[model samples]
Target: MIRAYHQPSAVEEALALVARGAVPVAGATGLYTGRSRREAELVDLTGLGLDTIGIHDDRIEIGATVSLQQLAMASSLPGMEGARLRRCCRHVASRPLRNMITAAGNVAHSVYWADLPVALLALDASLEVRRVGASPALVPIADATHGGKHAWDGGLITRIVVPRRAGTLSFGYERFTRTATDYSLSTACVTLRVDGSSARDVRFVVGAVSARPTRLVPVEAALEGSALSDDAISRALAALDRELPIAPNYRAPAEYRRELTQVLARRALETARTWAARENP
Candidate 1:
């Protein structure tokens, strides 16, 4: 059955309610639709003044409560940092769903098919979370999703921080799915920082094909200080597992998903390479 729904005016009150077993839900788009049976108090975070966006010192701070629609419509990022995020947000789902999906909710729930995690990983984003009776803490997206997801239990993500790079940032993203709103079969997010034709930093995140997102560490190392030419891209692709252990689903076979990952990842890196070349030219 249904019960209490509280919307606290302050963070402390919200924390207290959660400490006492209240479940936090903002943009309840994913929660209400899912076939969940257990019920409890719902702490609506529509208030508490957490839905603000701020920019400073080459970084953009996105409130956890900020809706995907809000982010999709953002005018600009100071240095165009994490530019790929806007596209990711815009395509998260249909218009109605995007309007009700909160950034915090999306990451907290982290439906395996979610795109935000890969985007955050590519941008090296960090999260700010508040725990029961404890001061707020900053955690890297990688760390927060590591080991066990229990890191956010009894806590709530307050904001996400995207650190801007000083040099030109080249970003590319691609998602493979049968339909526009259908969950992706595989997704790739890549960001490259190039200085005078040499790659300074590269982050390539592959998701939606496994239980957890995985970074191509060997590929990233190979991309360093080199222009991602056709040969270079080929070499990186060769390093990937011939057959990734992607869990099979009704939407696609595991082997097919692995092949798609290799293709999309190549395209993403190649596009990023072209963007980097533009910086030096």
Candidate 2:
């Protein structure tokens, strides 16, 4: 199908075009692989200068068009924050695809196999979205993904904001795949701070096995006030059966995915615990 393509240099112009039914695209990677073949007008968003990454005392701001590869190689990010982002981004597709995949596009597409959202969920990230006639809103990752496409119906995500925690934090991420570039079968990400000998501010997230990345509140609760001992980790793993939701996939059976998720989650937690102990000692 043939159609008009427009590259707007201003956010207002892009928003106006989107309001008029044009589909906005940064990398356009999802559009190529997307199932829908309907003819459509395309609005290019890369011209709007949404490609910079800024580090601030309170938060890190990533523009919508920032590539995963750019994030993986960013030198401004420090400590555990840099480590977590690099680890997750490096696991994303191959190098070439990572260069063409934008963070906003990845989150807005909201595919089950997406890895960035799982790490974002664990990091308590938020999105800044803009619409034609309304003030820009900062939406939490959890709420932004809660209603799927409906939450982003009329707005374009302009940037992502990750708040910096005050104290020392440890992070762990794990994913399982059939090949180096294959879509993930299951993924787990955890971030926690150790206070004395107990865990605090624990955020445990699991992805790919469900329709959307989900925070394991029950499992987080199990670890929140307890030492990350073997017994406590076992109890958290037991909570997975009740909290983790499985979606059917042709790549793997449901039972196999469930067990894989449990194992990956346990490993990620252990990794975080190890880091916490080393850093807190």
TM-score of each: 0.94, 0.96
Residue 271 accuracy (lDDT) in model 2? 96
Candidate 2 local lDDT, 73-160, one digit each (tens): 9877876776788789987889999999999888887789988888888989999989998998999988885444645566699999
**Local distance difference test, candidate 2:** 0.87
RMSD of every prediction: 1.8, 1.4
- Colliding residue pairs in candidate 1: none
Worst 10 residues of 1 by lDDT: 31-40
TM for candidate 2 is 0.96
Estimate every model's Cα lDDT from 0 to 1. Answer: 0.79, 0.87
Model 1 Cα lDDT, one tens digit per residue, 1-281: 54888989888898888878888888887775432225568888889898888988878899988888888888765654636778788787788988888888888876778778888888888899898779889888888875565467777888899887787879778898888888889998778887877776788788898766777777777777777877777777776654244776877777788889888988888888877777668
Q: Which one wins on TM-score? A: 2
